[model samples]
Target chain A: MAADETAPAPRGKVTITEIARRAGVSVPTVSRVVNGRSDVSPATRARVEDLLRLHGYRKRSAALPSRAALLDLVFNDLDSPWAVEIIRGVEEAAHAAGAGTVVSAIHGRSGDAGEWMRNLRARASDGVILVTSALEPPLHEQLRILGVPLVVVDPMGSPAFDTPTIGAANWSGGLAATEHLLSLGHRRIGLIAGPPRLLCSRARFDGYRAALEAAGVAIDASLVVPGDFHPESGFTGCNTLLDLPEPPTALFAASDQMALGAIEALRRRGLRVPEDMSVVGFDDLPEVRWSAPPLTTIRQPLADMGQLAVRTVLRLARGERPDSPRVELGTELVVRASTAPPAPVL
Target chain B: MAADETAPAPRGKVTITEIARRAGVSVPTVSRVVNGRSDVSPATRARVEDLLRLHGYRKRSAALPSRAALLDLVFNDLDSPWAVEIIRGVEEAAHAAGAGTVVSAIHGRSGDAGEWMRNLRARASDGVILVTSALEPPLHEQLRILGVPLVVVDPMGSPAFDTPTIGAANWSGGLAATEHLLSLGHRRIGLIAGPPRLLCSRARFDGYRAALEAAGVAIDASLVVPGDFHPESGFTGCNTLLDLPEPPTALFAASDQMALGAIEALRRRGLRVPEDMSVVGFDDLPEVRWSAPPLTTIRQPLADMGQLAVRTVLRLARGERPDSPRVELGTELVVRASTAPPAPVL
Candidate 1:
């Protein structure tokens, strides 16, 4: 029973009456202050000013033009620790840029895609930074149509979107991990790769394979187990790898959470890290450094990536074309107590 | 540029086309399924049934009542690791009750209250769980008027609104902390209290004072320092306390983060934990247990509190009076390696 009805829309204006009510002041005094009638005392004026500052109340009729503000942040998952750090970075940058951020968590579930589309349709934000794996076809199409300043973090997009991307050198980090194991004289090594759906996962896997091939080692498919970038999944993957006909002496996990899980699984099986099976993880989250025995992992420049992503998004929002649409931050092999020469075969 | 426009609203009759589109099926297939037409293949029927199960799509024209849905979980901040465990508990309980969650972070500058209000107004969540320390008067009043199921976590409301609250026994926890130090033969005890604006802070302070009074120890105003529940604040507070002429032998920090900060400050000043100054912390967050030498703290039943909050909110949303409006979970003293008898001051 929808029917056309005309009603005078309320103007987006703040009145003296509303301010006085908000500040718990008299309407007459508020009017006098607003109209510059000068009847209000200094204390009253200061109180009103404080109230205005607290509520972000600006006179709608003010002649000054304000800059249009919007921010887009890409997050791996709502629960992911990496996303938390990135969010902090993006938040700080957005606040400095005088804009607001719209965060979206990308998951493997298709329902999230539909929700993402709805969010895009609403145009709730000015630009988007796709944070997950490379954009899926449907999401990329929708984002392109929205036609805002776009930046992809941790995912290098296809030519269709041609947006700037910021990510770490995952492949090189993977190589460094494998090379470390090779230097430790480990003939058999296990690789716990992230989800196949993500390009970073594939890149890291490629690096692992390349390192193995360079060392003249046969790529044993059984040594490579698929993981979901979660600690639970890592534990399961480690168990599966450990139960193999011939288990590897060293393990390279694609994520710190997965590595921690691997360590737990190892411990449960009466295996000590480094002494039994050395492990190296990626992304070096804060907990990784503090984990029992401390994990030796590849350190992706997460904080730097976050700061750069924010700076890039800010530039895009300001109609400034960045010199490069793609940014590949560096990663270092943080040799900690977790990794050592593979122990002699029992 | 605003215009009054209305389109013909869909009627009460559940259209087969609408159901099929929503379920991603053909109209004739939906019609056959609805009418129990004999010509429909078993596979098509099963697919439609599965779709119906997934989307909760029902024939509105039929005299079937709609099932209740999940409630919204409005958290103040999500970055805190403590919030993660709480959320997991809430999520598990809510899922068991056939409810979903919509999480929102509401910590912007004080001026963005109106923006937060607008965001909350646009949300379609059934109820809200406010996991924050302090609620602004205006925002709180507005949320109360929404007439939805509301449960507050941590913050106890003023007598004006009788919304249910679930939290740890903060006061008792504080008393326990002080008593532990007292039992260890420490008369000079210092307190690092949380922000004064928080209800928990006041309750904890009261408990601390009560415990000292019970032990025939005079409360030293100079030994009390204000902390904002952050590690940095804890460090500063500890420094301030340590600088006093008659420094406290044992210190009780209101939160784990602050405790860690205090520990850092102590270590920086070349003092060892428990050896030079005994330390006790509240909220045994995961990292605290893994810190160097670990920390002795009060362990709040975070997960249980989360689950109870979710269940309570769900019941309220169903127009059912919860068995209890207030849930005060207990806190246990986890005597880790952080605290010991004060070293014999020669």
Candidate 2:
């Protein structure tokens, strides 16, 4: 210890909870002040610092279970049925843990990173659960210095070595959707795939390829088109596929929204779903069950993924490692009216 | 002044900003301590009070602008496309105003109200915007005492006299939808309506009735069915209509989800949307545009409603009343492929 610095108490002696109780602020605030975050009001920071000094506060020698009273749940966007399911699951998990959740969104605009960090510092959230957003290295370093726990859901890019992540088995899901179509005797199947850059999207595309090879069917480049995982992309992809010399009899879209768009394209041509073209969708969202011909889809356990993310984040917040650094939930085939044997003539 | 209470310097003077700046605390924290909220740490609250004494802070007789750096947005539930549109709108408005928004949900659980109120006080939000939830008198009283401005979006029930509210011209929308079907040579139109408890639902049902009466069509009680503004209700309502001795050739649903359900019901019965039975829906939600036969529906400016709520709340927070206590934005009729001349048979 420096001459002017008092020695920290014995390792594992003073917990964050005790310091927070004495400082008259939330535990996260104490963590923020200790990390030297600048957003905290000066007087509030000074009060928390005094308590830290009096207790001889020091960094934990090892990760230890320290429960937080709150967690922050952030989404890249909240416009889709996909995001709603995830939010519900997180809320349920948080409620069970008796912890409150603060919901936020970072649209990736300029200065959004700074604004988001400032808010997190102000709230002193115990842990952060980010859904479908890239994890930047600078952010990781800042959070590491603050000793804040972070877990990503369906991470956009390859996550850092230490970051825990939760996602569905997209490869299996894609293969299953394609195999179902093959079983329906549709050799010429079209794929409306999500953005090729996303890892999950690439996994799914690979799975589709594997299914074709397993069935001894030749993969045709003309049958596959890229979609941005939205309705318009699906519509445009389907239109592009229809323009091909030999349009596929069955279409498997990487997302439910895309499938709906494909259905719309077929409808415009006055062709009936299943009667003319068999369609399979991924992510059996709530809306699909009520679609004109209830859509057959690969059901990603989205809510389950969300629930697991919350549990993992809570564990991390308590200074414990998750049972696994990467967890992949299962996906299943949900057969509905949208898929069937292709028309004999086609 | 009481012996323990330091005498205030003057009447109608020191602003919340000056007190917050001098005390090195947030304006909301000062507001919370001033209102005797229990959530703040005692030590921090005491320090704030000492500064309040030194500055001789006094309540102003004039409505002074006390800007809260944060705003709170509470949703009755976060599960619907309806809610998402509103959230995006509020976010856009908040972003434009350069204020941070804190999103919350009150699922009508017993303690949710108390918990939400506490979080709001802790954050010291400048204003609160609630969507489709009734305002309880006690909460109203508490917010009023704290001088926090509040605005409701599509209020479920009659609001407190002072609370500003924004909604669409739902009755006009309902009337327009029914009239559009009637103009297409349909006499007996089936109506799938929302819950009776909600004011907006009642207005829409009444609109449907007014259009029928204006056209000299009898108000057949059997033609109108109550739905809960969801898919299942629409399905059930359509089934009920189909069971009637004479199911109407044209159907109008109070919401897009319900309309989708009605279409699904029609498809299950071996019917084509506009060819076998014409269907019209309200709320031109983004999903409906891509529905099998694009739906002709009434468009409620939901995003506009959200934006208006934020603007209204901010105005109130600054101690200004909105131009009107009840602001109803206009609804428009959007023609699409779903409606056409009714099939030649009943």
Candidate 3:
């Protein structure tokens, strides 16, 4: 041991041998007490524990108990507002369930699958709730091997694992959004689709096509544009669509944040929402309601989804198989001041 | 074991005895390999490690590794924009340091001190960079008991412990904000303060008082309103001040979020910012820059604070006592379009 406390030491890892020496006990006895070995007598156990505390000797890593008491609340990205709301919901339920959450960021799009997998393997959480669907194949496979009770939220594609999943009826919500514009007598409707890789985007696109077909309006591929489900992407996508020779009379964005951006783009070009271009959005977050014109959007049961995810994971961790392996929660369309009948073509 | 696997069947936890029996070794030999005790052969060590993985026999409650290969970036509130930016900064630094983060939120102001204590006692983190003031007595005492290498950010009132801390130059920031208002020729300026228990708030308030005294302006006790560092509190506090018979011509909020809320409250009463009353805020968060009229704010070195906090905690965890127990960083005043000369008295 060095006398210079402030000196840059190579490393200061305290070992069990040091604790045993300080406690005046055999290494085996110290191990027994640390591991709570039933064979150790009560008197010796107390003495060893006291000594361990005095020397700041923590429990050895190898003696970890088999049962997990903490829960892992996995989010696809830490920066997204949608994830924030869902996390708050999950946190509330987890608190009520007497479980602590270990938050891990799983970057879905950056191709950083190895980093996320390594984290999942290194951190020992009791159970896991996957809150995003954009996880790459390798990371998803790694999670499967993890063998913990798992729950998936808003899963993008088909059910890949035996674990339970909870998600909103995204397709129905898309239909409602498109139908609202159609009911407003807007025959030429354009859609801002989410990333092509995401299942939610595919479903929403399907619903959009279905709505147009049902209304006897020709489905124009040119009216659909791809977006990355971000505000900036929405703004860019809206600008591209609006640049067409005969642009859509109405626009439907898959997310509210994107819709807000679309409004900004429209305003920048001196166009008013609904008056010049009608817009409808999905996921009516609080900020959407506060937007200038108050966005017309679809509302998902985010809080309920969070509660369901936690409950499902807890049930699986407790060795109880839930009745439903896949849950599709409902969504509702909220009409506000953001949408109106398409302006008469001049 | 029971045959029924689906109905909450108890799979008795695998113990060291079972591992020894399966490996065909004595209990002491099994213990030696599991604990990485000296004198264990390589083959025996590998066999024990393989079995441990196969059985998923993790310790129920084990302290984090003494020499952590990763960092734990802890924050009191996860939803705040300021905290999020700081976390992003920590994430970038930790990535550069070849370390990972385990983000855990300690719900402050919700009055859940017991939960905070439990998480601290669990010792799930290697090193803690507390992005909050440990002014609460119970939490302060618990920090002493846990004794993990720690760093406090923006610690208020008194030093919670001898651990290193890093925070913005709150006193200077406060003075800058106040001086900006004074330069705008606003003599009747109101202050929206953070919690009194927090040292940052006290320093900012001291700066506010000093600026007024230095300018030969009399301090009006009635104009000073205290609030929790929350937007809602700011809204309420602003309403109270605005309702006073002799209202101030300007407002200086201690936080940007608070300043935004104050602006909203002022708008509700048909008062325009800078035109009717000037407003100055602290912390130039992204939202502040985009806010209507753009905010004139004091910018704290958020990213720097986060990086320093992580580095200091890691050093302390490695048994190096830092020379300075507290480190005060600096802040800059950013003059945007929010402040202007006050309107003449009605």
TM-scores for every predicted model: 0.54, 0.82, 0.68
Model 1 docking grade = incorrect
lDDT of 2 by residue, B1-346 (tens): 4554344433225666667766688888887777678999988887877665455444432211332146677877767767768877887787567565666667877477876776565445668898988657788876765667789889897775588889999999999999999999999899998989999999999999999999999988998998988998999899899899988989999999999999999888888889888899999988888888889999999989988998998887555569999999999999999999987754
Model with the higher TM-score, candidate 2 or 3: 2
| lDDT, residue B126, candidate 1 | 51
Best by lDDT: 2
lDDT of 1: 0.71
Q: What local lDDT does model 3 show for residue A253?
A: 94
What digit string (tens of lDDT, one per residue) describes model 1 on residues A63-165? 1123124455545455666765666566556545545454544455666666555544333345666676545776765554333457777873343566788
The total number of steric clashes, by the backbone 3 Å criterion, in model 2 comes to: 0
Clashes of each: 1, 0, 8
Judged by DockQ, which candidate is best? 2
- Give candidate 2's root-mean-square deviation (CA, Å): 7.7
List model 2 lDDT by residue over A82-135, tens digit each.
876787777767756756566666776637866677656544566788898854
- Shift of residue B13 alpha carbon in model 3, Å: 28
Residue-level error in angstroms, candidate 1, position B303:
2.1
